[model samples]
Target: MILRDVSFAVAPGESLAIVGSSGSGKSTLLGLLAGLDVPTRGSVSLNGIDIFALDEDGRARLRGELAGFVFQSFQLLPALNALENVMLPLELAGAKDARQRAEHSLAQVGLSARSLHRPQHLSGGEQQRVALARAFVTRPRILFADEPTGNLDHATGAQVIELMLELNRAQGTTLILVTHDVALAGRCGRQLRLEAGSVVQ
Candidate 1:
């Protein structure tokens, strides 16, 4: 296997950090682990469910049930308010009180005053906070964060990272973070190092 034979496991409620430079397949491994993509030669199981065995719709459903993600770019809909953006996944799951839950989530990320603001109206850090709120509103079993601090300045990024860690501890939610930042990765309980599309250590 050119990508290398890698085998490891994350305990329930554990946080695993993946660190590598760009093009090292850190993001690719995360995508597979989160069921956003399937591996060509290996199997990935999330919460004991084999993701590759499921069809696309099935994978989507499973992901909805178990996974959440925060990407580097802050993937929020430009037209949606902070509240609406956070409510999306919850509403998709048919939560009757999505609005209230979304409001609480936004507040947790310190964006209460900006709840009615759209992405374009917010600063980069604020928009990233919105993305974090949206990813976490569902209270997913696992969260995959790809370079979550990539867009923020040091102070803002530190606050955001603290929020994520706090949520993980309080909820016992598993976290898998892919990043090139060594300091950020060090905060995680266990670390997985990747190089050239392979797990190196």
Candidate 2:
């Protein structure tokens, strides 16, 4: 099992960080919580709804409606420009104001000037900013970030972290992150330490 006897609760608008050494199941726990993966045992619930009780499509719909995600790889599509990439999720959700919201999100991440640039044309920091803009464009209630700063240098990563925290506070979004960076984990309202797939603290 990738995770065992791992349990925790996050209050609304709280920031919780999961920290673990390599191979300790930090990302696995994040995936399960996000409903991207189902646990072999136990269940995950969001807002009192047991997500695993729903069908796969139902879980996906729930994620689109209430959750956002950021990854270590910055997962932007190579074919889409910054603005278009940010607009994709909103468009998928059938929002009529996708373009406007995408613009505002890009501006929030200090990427307004690079709105027309594709992922490959941007620097690592700029690309990650675009990813952040995309994640927050929908104003999701919960944001899950897995090693969001792992691909950046120290300075750029710090900037990204600051931006995430600012947005989380401003929007009252519940923030859950998986990280190996102790300093980054320390900034959260609470931290859960894991060892060998189980909660150690």
Candidate 3:
């Protein structure tokens, strides 16, 4: 098993950071929390609902309705431009104003001018901004980021961190992130340290 005996709860509107060395189960724990992977012997509750009790489709619907994700790799589709990428989740949810909401989200991330650019055409920081835009456009109740700044340089990473924190505060969205950066972890209201697939701190 990649993770063992890991249990924690995040209050609404709070920020929590999961910190660990490489291979310490940080990403695995995140996957479990996001309901992308099921736990073998435990439960994950979100918004007071036990996600593991639901079937795969049920859990997926829950995620779409209540959660957002940002990854280190900036998982924007290669075929779509920034606006289309950000608009995807909203469209998937059948929102009537997806285009408008997507444009607003991109503007919030300082990507208004780059909205027409594809991920491959933008800089790393710009691409990550697009990813952030996509994550928040749904106005999700919780946001999960896995190594969100891992691919950026120091200065660019700092900018992304600031923007994420700002958005979290502004929207009152619960934030959970996994990272190796001590400074990033420090910015969070609470920190959980993991070692050997267990909470060590």
Candidate 4:
């Protein structure tokens, strides 16, 4: 499989939006950059480290150290409550105060009242808020969000977007967002247009 020779860079503390129609390879590009997926050709680098040169375990370590992700589908573990879902990563990272950190992060997303509620018990917007808490709990240097607002109504989506930008601003975390929404794309600081698996702009 060819990677189609696309190249781009996101500055630290910047927000870059990737926009295109469906099937335009926006998600693939994101996966490669975030080290979630590998490319057959070329390479990906983050913070001066070449990702493609790393073995799988090395890449996994890099992801844990550098990246956070939010998806359109709230990929929360069904059995875990909001707090538990947010605690998962912190625990995995061996943080001694995982529960405390998780609680704070959930509260940051305004889900403190629903901490005991499982994903199924929460509404769409609430579920996404839980996801947002989980994504930021690690305080990752970079975040990749794929259509984070795709599952919400317009008003709810706007609120979610606002929270995301707020966190990005406060933490100076680099953000790369993939979306088909033109209005959402405009809100980002930089825009990359993709077509046929290549950056067109």
TM-score of each predicted structure versus truth: 0.96, 0.98, 0.98, 0.97
Residue-level lDDT tens digits of model 2 in 1-201: 889888789999999999989999999999999999988889888978899999999999999999999999999999999999999999998999999999999999998999999999999999998988998889999999999999999999999999999999999999999988777888899999999999996
Model 4 bad stretches (over 4 Å): 1-3
Q: Which tens-of-lDDT digit does each residue in 77-107 have in candidate 3?
A: 9999999999999999999999999999999
Segments in model 3 whose C-alpha atoms lie over 4 Å from true places? none
Note the Cα lDDT for every prediction shown. 0.88, 0.93, 0.95, 0.91
Error of 1 at 89 (Å): 0.8
Candidate 3 least-lDDT 10 residues: 1-10
- CA RMSD of all predictions: 1.2, 0.7, 0.8, 1.1
Model 4 per-residue lDDT tens digits across residues 93-193: 99999999999998899989999999999999999999999999999999999999999999999999999999999889999999987777888999998
Please give the ranking of all candidate structures by TM-score, highest first, separated by commas: 2, 3, 4, 1
Better of 3 and 4 by TM-score: 3
Clashes of each: 0, 0, 0, 0
Model 1 lDDT tens row, 1-201: 335677789998999899977778887788888777767788987788888999999999998998889998999998889899999999889999999999999988899999999899999889988988898899989999999998888888887888888888887889999977666888899999888867786
Sliding window of 10 residues with minimal summed lDDT for model 1: 1-10
